[model samples]
Target: MKRTDIYPMPEFFERYINLTDDVELKDAFAISLQELKQLPLDKWEAIGDKVYAPDKWTIKDILQHMIDTERILTYRALCIARGENARLPAFDEESYARHTDASNRTLEDLIDELSLVRASSLAMFNSFTEEMLQRSGLSFRGSYSVLALGFIVTGHQRWHLNIIKERYEVLG
Candidate 1:
């Protein structure tokens, strides 16, 4: 589906929406998965706990945040596809990162968990029919379709990956 198909674009999600190219959802998902799998784990480990700026997310925190956001977006897509009308709540990434103990975990472990979470998301999104993918629901940012959420999930990852490359200087 086209990006314009995602009506009533939420102001906050504009960056993510703009990051996405016009493409089929399945193709978008596949491209995102391949990009994610290509991220160099050794580079991420080498970065260690370094943050580009004070109070910014570290490499581990960023990875955890991506995993968390993907799960939430996937769940939202599932709910909307199933015709649920309840407005989904928003999550605080900083609070989540503060509470998460990624320091104790290895980069390999985080990558493994992220891969599993992404696989589950892919399966869930793949199960939806075209009509279901077009279904809309309320979220913190007003109305969003399942297909739009899928794009958002993909774009969100791309945004962070760009940050990893530019800010963290970690190239895959």
Candidate 2:
């Protein structure tokens, strides 16, 4: 691991301070990337195809979602790291979801695209210095210091993974 200073945890983080291992954020990111990578294409088709409701997200849709979220956040992180002081743009996730047509796309196509997107984002993430992750980003949606949001990105996918296993997988 690269040696860099971790910004002081935000006051808002008290509720979540112990929820995750701060040391493992990078590791978790790596593991999620690996998990998504190791999932067999056919298995993605079978399990992912059945994961969502008729009009809801399929497994491919979930992958699309993960990639999309990463895309937006990564760009925001870049803008902040570049010394941009502009407010963050508000995003309508439901609108994006509707317009993406992810629901109708084949599971394989979405996964391939998602895999590519993840690779791109991971490369970006690896390059970030701790200071860059702590920079503040402003947006109509709200203010989020890069350091604070980093945890969200790390934990958010795991949150969804559990949902897929418990809710969508129909596990007892």
Candidate 3:
């Protein structure tokens, strides 16, 4: 799915769409990667503790949501990078949200989980060669270049960060 937005979802990642194959999307990924890694526990917890606006999610919920997204999108990216040609299965985000209790878990734990997944994802991406970046494959959304699939990691993260910062944090 191609979604454009006003902030990071669109702007921060705008550089990726024009980038030709063989360039590391990791440089783009690195923009927010470290800062996201270093976000204080207090900040992460604050998102959890604040009461969100009507119909929005708590900071904890947002973090939990991002954690879930990282798992899904990275797997998709990896599958494409690894030469998978079949269509990936779709998952229901709303159903998963109801099954997990973001409220019960500490914000620190959620942050830790994000850190772990991101670390794994970074390692996975770093291991890919320029040839791998040029690989072609299909995902649940249909066919895409391996290079384009790689950009989804940071693009998706930046997408949610925009929501969290502007809506979840501000409105909370």
Candidate 4:
């Protein structure tokens, strides 16, 4: 399904969704994955847990955040597609980042986890029917369709990667 297929885009995630192409969900996933795999790991490693500014996340933190956020969003999509009316709880990124052992993990390992998560996400999204894709559920921010969630996953990665490029890349 294409971005255009999403009805009433979630306002809170507009910046992320806008960062993505007007392509099919599967295509968007492919492009995002490719971009992720091409990231300059050597440079990032050289930075070595440095944050560009105070209170900002390290490169590893950011990568872990991306994985965590995607998992939460994908789960919401699944619940919504299955006709669940219960409102999903919002996740605390700061808490997750602070508490996780992402610091000890190698960049390669984090990337591998991310790739596996994306693959799982793609499989889930592919299983949804047209009707399921259109299904909406209330979220922490607002209502979102399954298709929108899929695109948001791609765009959210794009958003963070852009931040890493624009901010973190300049540090080293």
Candidate 5:
């Protein structure tokens, strides 16, 4: 499904969804993955745990956050597509980051986890039929379609990539 098919877009997810192009959800994932794999890892490694601002997440932390969010979004899509009616619980990203051991992990390790999680997400979304893709479910913010979740996953990745480039990359 195309990004434009997402009707009555949930307010909270607008920023992430808007960052993506109005393309097929599968292609959005591919484009984002290609962009991710093309990042200058050597330069990013030089930045290490440095944060552009105080209390901001380091590169590794950001990578871990990406993996975590993708998994959550993918699971939400799965549950929604299966006709789940329960309002999914919202997660506290800051709390997850605070409890994470991303600080002790290498950038490579975090990136690997993110890549694996994204691959799983890609496979899962690709399995959904057009009708399943249109399935919507209630969340903490509001209702969201399976198609929107797929785009949000990719778009959220791009959002962080932009921050890393504009903010963190300069630190190198």
Candidate 6:
């Protein structure tokens, strides 16, 4: 499936869509996994609780957010692909960051969990048929397709990784 297959693009998601270059869903997923695997975990650990600015997320917080958001997007894709019509609610990232115990966990641990999560996501997405990939559903922001959600998952990670490179000085 291609990004063009996603109908009624959610306005808020345009940035993420633009960040992605791959038009094919499988290629997009593979690129996302490759980029994630190349993250400089050592540099992230070296930074250690450092936030680029006041009231900003720490490196650990960003990593945790990536994992959390990936899981949420994957779930949304699954639901949409299954033809669920429920309108999903929005999540408060700041609130989630504050409440999460990511600070207690090592970067290595988070990365490992992220790998597992991505693997599960791959398995689920790999099972989707073309019709399933084109399925759409209501969300807090707007309508989204299973294919778009898949791309969003990848692009969202790319967006965060760019921030990490620019703000946190973590080499990609």
Which candidate comes out best when scored by TM-score? 4
Q: Between candidates 5 and 6, which one is better according to lDDT?
A: 5
Model 1 agreement with the true structure over 74-109: per-residue lDDT tens digits: 989998999898898888888888999888888778
Could you tally the backbone clashes for each prediction? 0, 3, 2, 0, 0, 0
Candidate 2, residues 75-132: lDDT per residue as tens digits? 8767887778978786776677767777678866766776676677667766777677
Select the stronger candidate by TM-score from 1 and 6: 6
Output the better candidate (3/6) by TM-score: 6
Pull out the clashing pairs in model 2. Answer: 87-138, 88-138, 88-139
In candidate 4 the C-alpha lDDT for residue 23 amounts to 90
Most accurate candidate by lDDT: 4
Candidates' TM-scores?
0.91, 0.74, 0.75, 0.97, 0.96, 0.92
Q: Give the per-residue Cα lDDT of candidate 2 at 137.
A: 72
What C-alpha lDDT values do all the predictions have?
0.83, 0.63, 0.64, 0.91, 0.90, 0.83
Error of 4 at 159 (Å): 0.6
Question: Distance from true position, residue 92, model 2, in Å?
Answer: 0.9
Which structure is stronger by TM-score: 1 or 3? 1
In Å, residue 172's CA in model 6 sits off its true spot by 13
Judged by whole-model lDDT over C-alpha atoms, candidate 3 comes out at 0.64
Q: Which has the better lDDT: candidate 1, or candidate 5?
A: 5
For model 2 the local lDDT of residue 87 reads 84
Residue 127's lDDT in candidate 2: 76
Q: List the residue pairs that clash in candidate 4.
A: none
Better-scoring candidate (TM-score), 4 or 5: 4
Models ranked on TM-score: 4, 5, 6, 1, 3, 2
